[model samples]
Target: MTSLFAQEIRLSKRHEDIVSQRLMLLQQMENKLGDQNKEKTPQMQRAETALQRNLSLLKDIEAAEKSLQTQNHPVPPPEVASLETLYWASVEEYIPKWEQFLLGRAPYPIGVENPNEAEATIQKEVRQ
Candidate 1:
């Protein structure tokens, strides 16, 4: 264990790593579940349960980190906090609510165009 600040960074990293693991797990499980050639074994069910539990734990850890940031005087390392927030948020859109693993739809985060908003922005030429 480390200081709160250090832990923040560590947990942030952990969260990211877990997200990747979980997503990969989800995909793997999805394939297993879909394959009609094989029967669903008890081991497969156990693995699914384990993944959900781990995801829940990670979500709890993130919530605790946010609370620490709010309560503490100093902002807990700025770079760590900012990056953690970004990583957590980026994954948030994908991870399903507890017991709600809808593998059919993966909310992969990506950049998208908002033409209306882009048009609203005043360019230098328009300003002049």
Candidate 2:
């Protein structure tokens, strides 16, 4: 890949990471507010407003990505695609522990599975 292509890929992945973080935050807020008996405080009201805004933003991002793809954006080659898929799968697995830390449900954000172990598992899955 050219340097410019590499940079574009990095930027795209970063955008995806930011979107995932926003979704996680929204999920955390929703879980906290799941209790119907709880009164809506100012903070809760703010969270609700933010949730709506985030949902709208997420929809817009998805639509923009679809438009770009339809407009002939370059697709990554198979090798890059496979590696990216594995990278994202690992990220998805780690996100829950990070979310728990952010929500104060955990003291630290380390994933339950060892990184090496996770890599091995992913490689095994790929081989199969």
Candidate 3:
């Protein structure tokens, strides 16, 4: 009976060791993941800031072009009117697309599942 109890105690120690190793590994993984997530936060913020800057610059350019057209054709020149009409049409067509591009994606794509691959692709293009 004593031998049987000793064997059971040994088995329990082995099981405890296995559980301890698993817990240690899990803690290490959590720490690594936390570090990675921290690294990605700043990268995501930069990407978002860049995208906003690009969109703002594009809007500014478009507004300047419209202003120039208005100045050059105070009396509604046919060319200016045509240009204005086309510009607005283009804006109407593109605003939804741009909104979708800006607001529709996961921030990080390197390690996690990214639902915003499309936006990420646009961000990549803008960076290039």
Top model by lDDT, which number? 2
Q: Tens digit of lDDT per residue, candidate 1, span 1-128? A: 56998999999999999999999999998997777435656668888999999999999999999889888866578767766766576457435532143554534323224555434432322333
lDDT of each: 0.67, 0.81, 0.77
C-alpha lDDT of residue 49 in model 3: 100
Most TM-score-accurate candidate: 3
Candidate 3: the clashing residue pairs are 105-116
The residue-by-residue lDDT of candidate 3 on 1-128, one tens digit each, is 99999999999999999999999999999999999999999999999999999999999999999999989868977777766776676567557656655686533324224558645654554444
Q: After superposition, how far is residue 67 of candidate 3 from its true place, in Å?
A: 3.4
Model 2 global lDDT (CA atoms, 0 to 1): 0.81
- Cα deviation in Å at residue 62, candidate 3? 1.8
lDDT of 1: 0.67
